[model samples]
Target: MSVIVLDKLTKDFKNGRGVFDVSISVKRGECYGFLGPNGAGKSTTMRHLMGFYQPQSGSATIDGLNCWRDQKQLQSKIGYLPGEIAFPVDMTGKNYIRMIAKMRGMKDLSYEKELEDFFEINPASELRRMSKGMKQKVGIILAFMHKPELLLLDEPSSGLDPLMQSKFIELMERFKKAGTTILLSSHMFEEVERTCDRIGIIKNGRMIQEINATELRHSRLKTFELECEEEADLNKLLVQFPKMLYDRQTRIVRISVPDSRINELIAALSVCRLRYLKEEKHTLEEYFMQFYGGKSNV
Candidate 1:
């Protein structure tokens, strides 16, 4: 079952910027990641999905409900965390959550204790005085406590520490097991690699690629460092593998080849009197750069 669908969705802002002809879908009980660099229209797409802005063309639907026409009904089933946080200065974390609960007409604060125990957040702290990480924890708890069917998280772990980030990942896993559909939008590739089943990469307001995490990992290039007793004429071998990248300096050679061609590369390199040889798989950052046309810096 597809919980969310974007059919050629296009949005243009007054300044002539926004996503263009985007089409993607998130299946029920699946976690999909929306990834892009800063200023790449990720937030614009999310805003349209949340009904903050209407599309210039095409359509977006959530659970068969038109996002723009059924805002109220759709919102009730979705939990959202914006990229930025701005809470009332006078309210404590507890009061803020209570207010949201009252507005949603949901009672039963039983989950409050569970959230506090897992996140180690003190609800008594004033919103203004809490640390950024603490504030983020509060937002996460609020989003999950209601048990909404769909979650829209924008850079959800921006302010969290490593420990809390791990815990949040665990929480997402639990939510997935419970059959919740999640759309995670973030610049953090590692988080997406860990939590999402599939990822869509947006570049300059256009989606460039959509691939599964497992497939991406398997398709990544493998890096190898080779040192020979004497300068080796590896050009002939390199030409055999079109995907391989090689650099040689002072009897030291560095080679990178797609994972699928590693066996051929290994057989070719075996003939040389190698002083040193090491092979390593590329990380998610490397895969993103290769697929999305960017520098390999995560």
Candidate 2:
């Protein structure tokens, strides 16, 4: 069943930048990857789901509860990590975690301690003196200590190092295994590809594509990079494969052929004098760049 739903959700800013007609549904035990660069309304849509922003039109709901109107009551049911974090400078991380836990009426520090150890964090450190990565770890602990039914994470691994990022991914894997629902909004492609079951690519305040991660992982499509011994060979391939991407400087043509057509491609390339033929692995990052005109500002 769908635990999270957005119906034609829209939020307009005065500067003419905001999400328009945005809609997405995240099911129970499913991790939904929300992808977009900065200023693409990814954070805006997340805020609506968290009931931090009221929509100009449409609606957002979590488990049939109105996100905006039922936010106070729904707070306990969801864990959220905002893109930017702010902490009280005077308080130690331990104090802050305890205070938030007390508000939730949680008396147990067992899980909290486990989390601190797993992330290698010293929550007793002064909040103001902590590094950016340390602060991020604290935010992570705050969000997951309670183990809510749903998690809404915006750039959860933002300040983490490579080691910490891997740890975070492992943590998410455990969460998924335990049937936790998650909405992960991030610009990082590899993390999303690894953790999410499905993905929605949003750009310029609009969703351009939605795809199943499994399909991408097992796609029959393959990219071939072939360098020609002579420029004529490159011309022949380009003329034969109009869909091919050619580079005159490198004297190579890039062709995407399905597994079924590999033989046909091989036959066609045999007639031309070839320097080298190589199969290139198609990455989620490369697929995303296609929508962004093969370039990205972010």
Sum up the clashes in candidate 2. Answer: 0
Best by lDDT: 2
Q: Estimate the lDDT of model 2.
A: 0.89
Model 1, runs deviating above 4 Å: 14-16, 221-281, 290-298
| Model 2: per-residue Cα lDDT over 73-151, one tens digit each | 8999888998998899899999999999999989888999999999988878899999999999999999999988899
TM-scores for all candidates: the values are 0.78, 0.80
How many residue pairs in model 1 have overlapping backbones? 0
lDDT by candidate, in order shown:
0.83, 0.89
Residue-level lDDT for 106 in candidate 1:
82
